[model samples]
Target chain A: MILCDIGNTYIHFCDTYKIWKNLPDEINKKELSSDVYYISVNSINEKKLLKAHKNSYNIASIVNLDTPYVGLGIDRKAACLGVENGVIIDAGSAITVDVMDAGNHLGGIILPGLAAYTQAYRSISPALEKRINFGMDFDELPLNTQSAISYGAIKSVVLTIKEIVGDKKAYFTGGDGKFLAKFFEKAIYSEMLVFNGMQISIDKALKKHKEQK
Target chain B: MILCDIGNTYIHFCDTYKIWKNLPDEINKKELSSDVYYISVNSINEKKLLKAHKNSYNIASIVNLDTPYVGLGIDRKAACLGVENGVIIDAGSAITVDVMDAGNHLGGIILPGLAAYTQAYRSISPALEKRINFGMDFDELPLNTQSAISYGAIKSVVLTIKEIVGDKKAYFTGGDGKFLAKFFEKAIYSEMLVFNGMQISIDKALKKHKEQK
Candidate 1:
């Protein structure tokens, strides 16, 4: 069985969070089992993956349960399916905070990432358009223009996530998962969210295939 | 005595925070005192104000205090003089949090206004870029994508201001001063920060004129 999750920055294939740089030359040469499941934010790679194993390639969206918003991404659907109850935060080009309760999706929010916050500050005020350091040490009282905007934006994201999770367990994923992990009280960083959900899906498909025969 | 402050969005004249839409057709016809004082972000207006009272006018920057960053705005310089100590937050096109202590400008931060924050988010992520609702009811757990980013950005500004103020008094000015004022425990909303500062400078300039005579 093969599992894949495509994001804006990288196409993550399997549980290691390893990026799939290019389509493999041959699907048969991959030497993997026939069953395959995948999800993606970038639609460009969707057709290529499906054509590789047209008969066995299963798009993860059709295997879903309850989703809060209509047309929610399959990647989020898979992430939501990873746990029965908790808050899942996927921090990438965009950050999403979804509250899950016993397989029921209560609600969620999507915010701009750290870079977006800083870029916004620059665009509004031409006087402050110059790029400033975002990696500066965190100071409760910002010492300069760069520190204030950068720290203020970062702290906002942290507080928002904390407010949503409250007493529930929190899960972090995506490119910025590790950075967000350290800030949470009981947050677990996982690369297996999409992959794990795919496992359950492929098993069900296999059972269905046997019954059809 | 005439006091004027030119901002990016509007020009404010008089000892109050009243915005001036245009230069009066005839300054001489107003029949006020000939002593004119002014400062501006737009250089075009600076010349107009200076031309009106070129014979006896005194530009504000000459009457001053210890400014931390060179080329600090006269509006901020006047705000620093409004209080001996504490932080001043001017929330307009750009929200500035300046630290003033014992008549010296320690330092400050410049962040984007509310609109800028939203614009930034839209630029980065096209999928979540659709307009949701920035004015939606506030919730601990956001109900939708729009509410999350908007409320999260707003709350961040509040927390950052609180963090900087600590136990000290926080003075808020600018267009959104009242909105931000509500979020702080010890925050005082004042329209007179810049105007009052200008008053002190004008007074000193007058006293110095007499001394020279």
Candidate 2:
């Protein structure tokens, strides 16, 4: 089975067993299996990928997330399914935190990621361009303008988690997941959460297919 | 004397007495004071403001910001002068928290303001643009995407304050000063902290001018 998840930046592809992240543009469709399930938040990117793999495999029924939450992306919904009851933080272009207790969706918050926060200011004030550098000490207060921005952007996530997550177990997946997970010892790092979730959805669909047959 | 501060989004202008914010593009150069002090983080905006008022005022020796830290904006310097032994939170397009004590500069951190945080994600993912709205309860976990963003953005400031400030005095200034000041009962809300700081600098400059005379 082949599983694919698309975000604002990159397309994540996975097999039922392993994962291939940030897949190249020229896809080698040879590795893909008979079953495929795909979900995306970027429509144009999704269309392009689907067009490339016109007749690749048997596509499974992708889960519908729009009904429950108007514009909740598949990546988030899938990540939620991957976890039972915990605060899931997707630290991608946007750092999103969703809390689920007893499989009931309590709520989620989406704030700026590191790059997004810096770009937010740099886009408006060109003077601040290239002013700040990342990979700083989140504990200490920064002296210069750029360093100040870096500390603020990075620490805001940790600070937000501390405020909202409280006693809930924290799980993370995304590009910056490892770096962010370093801040907290207990945060469960799930590098392939969305893929694990895809497998679950695909298995359920396949079982239903056999019953229908 | 005319005092002007250029932030990421708005230009705050204040005479020794009255103040004007987000001045119109067509600047009324008449009734202008001879002495003007200016500070800016946006170079282009500052250039335009200076160009418009060319030869209109002596541009009073803009308040000199004497600090070891480089790239520290005069606006921040002025605000520092506006307070004593406290943490200054400037909640503008960027939320900046600076610590000052005993007439010495400790350090500061800059985070994304509410708008900046939202814009960070909204700019990249247009789908997220209209999905989230502001004005949500920060204490409670939000069920919707927009409310989560709203709660995260606003509550982040409050959380940052609690983490960093820690028993220190909290002084807030900028557009969202009053709204954020409500988060803490003891937080001092200043409508024109930058302006007040500019006034102090101007006074010191004038005093030095007198001593030189």
Candidate 3:
């Protein structure tokens, strides 16, 4: 089976051995020869992807989890469902840190990612428009303009996540997940975490469909 | 005598009895019958203010503080000079947290303030465009979008300050300083912190000038 994750910008397609990204308009119907499971945040692209594959399934409807957070994104929900117990950090455009304990989502907070951070600083003053120094020393307070802003942008987010996760095992995913995971002693970085969630939901959906038929 | 703090937007003036602000262009030389001592970040306004008052003294040339942080703002330096031992938080357009111990400046970090934070979220996605909920409970993980973003913006900055401050008294100033001071156990909100620093520097300069004479 093929797996897909549709975002605002691109549609990511994954098979058994390869994963590639294409624009929503570039999706070809003739390419899919098997069942496809997907989760999407973009409605228009989701419909296009659904039309490309006759057996396409949006896993959002199938994935079940306990969460009290209203308006929580499906991507975050899927990541939580991927893990039975742990903290989930999806460091994409926004760094979302969610706490999952024994298959239940406790709650989470949202932080702007690196680009968003840079934009925030630039908006305050043009002099503060420096690239985030990810490699700066976190142990000592920064003593320079670049390092000071860097410490604020990176350390503040890291400290917030650290305080929340505590001793809980943290599961990291998304583009910047690996970089963030390094700050914690018990962090697991998995690129396929969202896909893993989609697969679980697909399994449950197929079983329910079979029983009904 | 009069004290003035010139910023990009306004020129704040303080007398023994009252305080008022005026635009840089609205400054009148004839209105200043007494000596005016000022510190300014806006160079063009600084020149304009200096030309307006013949007896005006820029306090940036007088205050002495031991700091290793290169390119630190003069306003921040003044705030540090105002206190002998404490953490200084100037929460204006940006929240600058500085660590000063026993008359020595350790270092500081900068975070975007409320307006900048709002802009950051809006840039990420319009759905995230919500005013910062400063009243959100810090102890609880947020269960809604607004609270989640609020917790991230406010709590993250507060926690960062908390970890650095530890047992030190925090001296808060700037526009948003009063709101942030509530989160700390030992915080003093002072509106005249920068002016206090300017006073200290002026006294020192006068004593030195008398000794030379």
Candidate 4:
């Protein structure tokens, strides 16, 4: 089976549960054949999917779940599916938290990412338009404007998350997952958890369809 | 005495305690003379003050308190002075809470105002960019995107203020002060509180300077 998780930045393709960072160039390669291909994407560029499909003839299926096409964020839903009963935090271009109760999903928090929040403030307030890098050792006493903003946003998010989760476990994923993990307790970084969750959702759906027969 | 409070959008002038919605065109008129003129402005042209001074020969004294320009918001300091021992909330372009204990000012909370919060979200997220009119009915469910945004911001501010004040009195001021007054246990809408505060500040400064003799 082949699973493809497409996000805003890059695409991840996995075969037999192992992610292939670099795909082989040649099409019709015998080793690339798989019984099933399940694709979930935020972008509906058919050409990209078709190119990947041509390389594997055993690909008997294809799925597209693009934005506005699929309704909600597929990655968010998938992240929720990956956890049994915990908060799943996705820290990418934006930060979102999806809470899962057993296998059921609950609505979560969505806010601009750290960079986006600071950038938006800078853009709106011409007097405060400046860039500053966020580091692990954020100054307790923020001396500059950028640091003050960065510290406030980061502290607010961290405190908010802590307040919401209480003693519950938290699962961190996405580009800044590892960075945030250090600040949160019971937080484990999982780069492919969202993709894994998508695969699990597809498998469950397929299984339910087969059982109806 | 003439007290003028120049805000982000409006200039409120008062002769004694009676508010004049518009500045008098003929300040030289016999009816317009005042012994003292205290002006507190956030974003008004300096020429208006000069004009006021030129017209009033009885304007024996003049005072102007610079706003948002001095690193801290003028509204904040004014709110601090308006209340003796309570939470002073300024719900205008931005919602700020200044906590005062026994007339001594403590730092406070600063967040986007009701309109600004919704507007910021709408601007950043294309899906939610719509104008919303907020209301007073706390139990009423939000029917649309605008109401939802308004409800969320209002609820957040109310909760934060309640938490901060606990058992103390609460004072509300600003353009949207009336709207927020309904949520607090004891909230009085004082449109000229900031101007009054400026007058008090000036009086205190003068008193202290005289005592140095």
DockQ of each: 0.39, 0.67, 0.67, 0.09
What DockQ was computed for model 3? 0.67
TM-score computed on alpha carbons, candidate 2: 0.90
Query: Which candidate gets the maximum lDDT versus the true structure?
Result: 3
lDDT of candidate 3 over B108-176, digit per residue (tens) = 998887667878877877667899987788789889889888888887788888877889999998778
Candidate 3's C-alpha runs over 4 A off are A8-13, A20-37, A42-59, B7-12, B17-36, B42-59
* Candidate 3 global CA lDDT score: 0.83
Which digits, one per residue and each the tens of the lDDT, describe model 4 over residues A103-201?
A: 655445554455554554444344344553458244333334454345445655565556446688988877677877788878888877767776776
Q: After superposition, how far is residue B123 of candidate 3 from its true place, in Å?
A: 1.1
In model 2 chain A, which range of ten residues has the least summed lDDT?
A58-67
Which whole-number lDDT from 0 to 100 does residue A164 have in model 3?
Answer: 86
Q: Residues A1-213, candidate 2, lDDT per residue (tens digit)?
A: 577887777777777557666543655567654545677777777776777676433232455332244456678888887777888888887888887777766678787776777687686466456544557776667777778776776677788886767777889899888788887767899778877777777777779889999
Q: What's the residue-level lDDT of B82 in candidate 4? A: 54
Q: Lowest-scoring 10 consecutive residues by lDDT in candidate 4 chain A?
A: A58-67
Give native contacts recovered, as a fraction, per prediction. Answer: 0.52, 0.76, 0.83, 0.00
Evaluated at residue B31, the lDDT of candidate 2 is 43
Scored against the true structure, residue B118 in model 1 reaches a CA lDDT of 68
Instruction: Please identify which of the two predictions, 1 or 2, would achieve the higher lDDT against the true structure.
Output: 2
Separate clash counts for every candidate: 0, 2, 0, 0
Docking class of 2: medium
